[model samples]
Structure formats: C-alpha cells, structure tokens
Target chain A: EPEVTQTPSHQVTQMGQEVILRCVPISNHLYFYWYRQILGQKVEFLVSFYNNEISEKSEIFDDQFSVERPDGSNFTLKIRSTKLEDSAMYFCASSEALGGYEQYFGPGTRLTVT
Target chain B: DQQVKQNSPSLSVQEGRISILNCDYTNSMFDYFLWYKKYPAEGPTFLISISSIKDKNEDGRFTVFLNKSAKHLSLHIVPSQPGDSAVYFCAAKLGGYGNKLVFGAGTILRVKS
Candidate 1:
C-alpha cells in the first residue's frame, strides 16, 4: 500500500534557527495536513493544505509556522524561529476525499530544538 | 477542554481473550469516530472507523462500536494476540466540510501471550 513519507526522520536545531520539515504525501491524495505530538501529549492539528492554500489552522499554528507545496509531491512546514516548546513529533497526513474521510499518516519527523 | 477523552490510561488482556478499549467525547457535532494503533517510533496507523449513521463496523478481528446517545465509542479485539499490543488512540471528526480531528490521550493495550 502507498503511504505518506517524511524526510529527516529526526531534526535537531538551535533555538533561534529556522527549520523545515518535509513530507511527500500519497501521489493521488488531494488534501494534506500537519499535526504535532508533544511528548506525553495528544496529537494536535497544525494546519491543512489544499490547492496550494491553507484551508484551516489551529491557534498553535502561529506567525512562526508556515506550510508550502513547492512541488507536485512535496509538502513542507517551516518554522521561522524554533522555540524549546516547538520540539515535538511532527506528522504529515493525507486523505483521498474531504470531510470525515480516513487519513493516512506518515512515520513522523521528531524535531528537537535546544 | 478535551473534546475527546479516553479515560483508561492502560489495559492488559490475556491472549485469546476479548479486549475492549473505551472512549468518550464531549462534542455532539462529532459524527465520525476512528481508532488508530501506534507502536514505538512510528506514527498512529488507521485501524477502523464508524459513522454516526451506523452503530457498528467490523473488519476481520477488529470491530468498532459507537453509541451516539452516550457520546461514547469502543473498539473490541477478539482473540487478542501479542502482536496486538500497542497504544490505541480514539479520534473524532465533525461530519461534512469539517476537516479537523480531535484525538484522545490514548490507551495503552497489552495483549499478553
């Protein structure tokens, strides 16, 4: 079965540095999403992307966060300045249809900021 | 406030027995519910899902039961095996154009052989 794939299984960056997490969602998927899980916490939604524009975002997705579909296959989340609290497991997901459809998730990228 | 809640932090069941994992939600607008399984170092994997229109949905050894009136749902694994041990997460989504999903804290299930 085809699955979503994320690059740099783990990322480590300085507190004030910029970092980008990349994902390649299923080829045929039209909707993409980003979620994060702080250690020992529930997974939280960050943002959703469709047609190269953000569909919706959570309060957690603030000014420092941005998402891009720079190419047909790549979806990326960039943090302008990493904070210690930003360290978490970032996951990428995709669904074939919209609205309450089952989403397929990637292995996730563990971001660690010091 | 947590829209979705899994009260049990962990559960252990003997092999070949039935394992039931429970979940509750505070949101009435959530019409779709899903269960996911996760192993260490991996993301949550889709297990099964049920719509409010149906009371139950089953696939092989996995079955999901939803109680819309009670605002609760449960996943039943019959004849559980050691391989079934993992953290199970319950997620809810509002039907229609709503794309955001609210997930519970998760319940760690240990199916001992």
Candidate 2:
C-alpha cells in the first residue's frame, strides 16, 4: 500500500537556527497535516494544509512555524528559529477526505535542538 | 487539552486471549473517533474508526464499541497474537473539514506468546 514518507529521519540543529522538515504524503490524498510528540507526551497537532493554504493551526504553530507545498508531492514544515522545547518527533499525515476518513501517517522525523 | 484520555498505561495478555483497551473523552464536539497502532521508530498506523452516528464497527479481530452517552469507547482484540503487541493511541476529531485530531497518551500492549 502507498504510505506517507518523510525525509531526514533524524535532524539535529543548534538553537536559534532554521530547520525544514519535509514530507511526501500519499500521492492521491488531498489534505495534509503536521503533528508532534515531545518525549513521554501525547501527540499534538501543529497545522493542517490544503490548497496551498493553512486550514487550521494550534498555539504551538506560532510565527516561527510555516508550511509549504512547494511541489505537487512535497509538503514541508519550516521553523524560523528552533528552541529547545521544539525538539520532538514531527509527523506528517494525509487523508483522502475529511470527516470520516482516516489519516495515514509517516514514520516521522525526530528533531533535536541543542 | 485533556479532551481525550486513555487511563491505562500498559497491558499484558497471554496469546489467544482477549485484549480490551478503553478510552474516554471529555469533549462532546468530537464527532469521530479512531484507534492507531505504533511500533518503536515508526509512526502511528490507522487501525479502525467509528463515526458518532454508529455504536459499533468491526474489522477482522478488532471491534470498536462506542458509548456516546458515557463519552467512552473501547477497542477489543480477540485471540490476540504476539504480533499485535504495540502502543495503541485513541484519537478524536470534530465533524468538519480541516479539524485537528486530539490524541490521548497511548496504551502499550504486550501480547505474550
């Protein structure tokens, strides 16, 4: 079965540096989302993207965060400046439709900021 | 937070036994519920889901039961096998488009052979 895939499975960056996490969602899926899980914490929603615009975002998705669908298959989350608290496992997900459909998730990129 | 809650931290069941995982939610606006399985170093994999309009949904050995009145749901795995061991997460979402999913702390299951 086709699955969502992410690049740079593990990323290490210095605090205050910019970083980009990339994802290639299931080809035919229309809606894309980004979520993160700090160690020993529940997965938290970051933002949702559709039609090249942000549909929804959480407080954690502040000015420092931005998402882009620069190409047909690539969806990326860029953090303008990384903070120690930003270190987490960032996941990308996509669904064929909203509401009742289940979103498929990628293996996730582990971001570590020091 | 705290919209979704999985009270159990871990569970162990003997092979071929029944395993039940329970979840509770505090948000009534959530109209959809889903269960996901995750292994180490991997992302969550969708297992099954049930809409608020339905009380139950079944697929293979897995059956999801929803009690809308009590704001609770449970996932039952019958004849559990060792391969079924993993961390299970319960998630909820609103009914409309672009709504974010609220996830509970996952419950770890160990199906021993």
Candidate 3:
C-alpha cells in the first residue's frame, strides 16, 4: 500500500537554529498534517494544510512554527528557532478525504535540539 | 485539557484470548473516533475507525464499538497474537473538513504466548 514518506529520519540541531522537516504524503492525498509527541507524552497536533493554506492549527503551533506545501508532493514544517523543549518525534500524516476518513502516518522524524 | 482519555496505561493478554481496550472522550463535539497501533520506532498505524452515527464497525479480527450517548469507545481484538503487541492510541476528530485530531495518552498492549 502507498504510505507517507519523510526525509531525514532523525535530525540534530543546535538551539536557536532553524530546522525544516520534510514529508511526501501519498500522491493522491489532498489533506496533510504535522504532529509531535514529546517523550512519554501524547501526540499533539501542530497544523493541517490543504490547498496551499493552513486549515487548522493548535496552540502548540506558535509563531516559530510554519508549514508549506513547497511542491505538489512535498509538505514541510519549519521551526524558525529550535528550543530544547522542541526535542520530540515529529510525524506527518495525510488523508485522501475529509471527515471520518483514516489518516495515514509516516514513520516520523525524530528531532533533537541541544 | 485532555479531550480524549485512555485510562489504562497498559494491558496484558495471553495468546488466543480476546483483548479489549477502552477509551473515552469528554468532548461531545467529536463525531469520529479512530484506533491506531504503534510499535517501537514506528509511526501510528490506522487499525479501524467508527463514525458517531454507528455503534459498531468490524474489520477482520478487529472490531470497534462506539457509544455516542456515553462518549465511550472500545477496540476488540479477537484471538490475539503475539504480534499484536503494541501501543494503542485512540484519537478523536471533530465533524468538519480536515479537522485536527486529538489523541489519548495511549495504552501499551502486550499479547504474550
């Protein structure tokens, strides 16, 4: 089955540096999302993107965070400044349809900021 | 505030036995529920989902039951196998176009032989 793929399975960045996580959602998927899970914590939603615009975002998705569909197939999340608390597993998901449809997730990119 | 809650941190079941994992949501606005399975170092895998309009949805050995009145849902795995061991997460979503998902803390399930 087709699945979402993310680049740089793991990333290590210095504090205050900018980091961009990339994802290639399923080719036919129309909606994309980014979520993060701190160690021993529940997965938290970051933002959702569709039609080249942000559809929804959580409080966790603050000024430092932004998402872009740089290309028709690539969805990227950029953090303007990485903080120590930013260390977590960032996941990318996509769905073919809206409302009650299953969203498929990528293996995830482990972001470590020191 | 945690809109979705999975009270059990973990569950252990013998092979071939039935394993039931429960979840509850405090948000009545959530009209869709989904269950995902995750192994170490992997992303959450979609197992099954149920709409608020329905009470039950079955897929092979996995079945999902939703009780709208109680704001509760459960995932049932029949004749569980060792490979079924993983962390199960219950997620809820609102009724809209491409809404964000609210996830529970997750329940670690171990199906032992």
DockQ for all models, in order?
A: 0.74, 0.86, 0.82
Residues A1-114 of candidate 3: C-alpha lDDT, one tens digit per residue: 999999889999999999999999999999899999999999999998888899888899999999999888899999999999999999999997644378899999999999
Each model's Cα RMSD:
1.1, 0.9, 0.9
DockQ of predicted candidate 1: 0.74
Flag the better candidate by DockQ, 1 or 2.
2
Error of 3 at B39 (Å): 0.5
**At residue B93, what lDDT does model 3 achieve?**
90
Task: Summarize candidate 3's per-residue lDDT along B25-80 as a digit string, tens digits.
Answer: 99998988999999999999999999889999999999999998899999999989
Error of 3 at A83 (Å): 0.6
Top-down lDDT ranking: 2, 3, 1
lDDT of 1 by residue, A17-75 (tens): 99999999999999899999999999998988888899889999999999999999999
TM-score of chain A of each: 0.97, 0.97, 0.97
Full candidate order by TM-score, most accurate first: 2, 3, 1
| Candidate 2 residue lDDT tens string, A29-93 | 88999999999999999998888899889999999999999999999999999999999999999
Q: Mind listing the fnat for each candidate?
A: 0.56, 0.83, 0.75
Local accuracy of candidate 2 as per-residue lDDT tens digits, B1-113? 88999999999999999999999999899988999999999999999999999999999999999999999999999989999999999999876667689999999999999
Candidate 3: the clashing residue pairs are: none
TM-score to native of every candidate shown: 0.97, 0.98, 0.98
Error of 2 at B35 (Å): 0.2
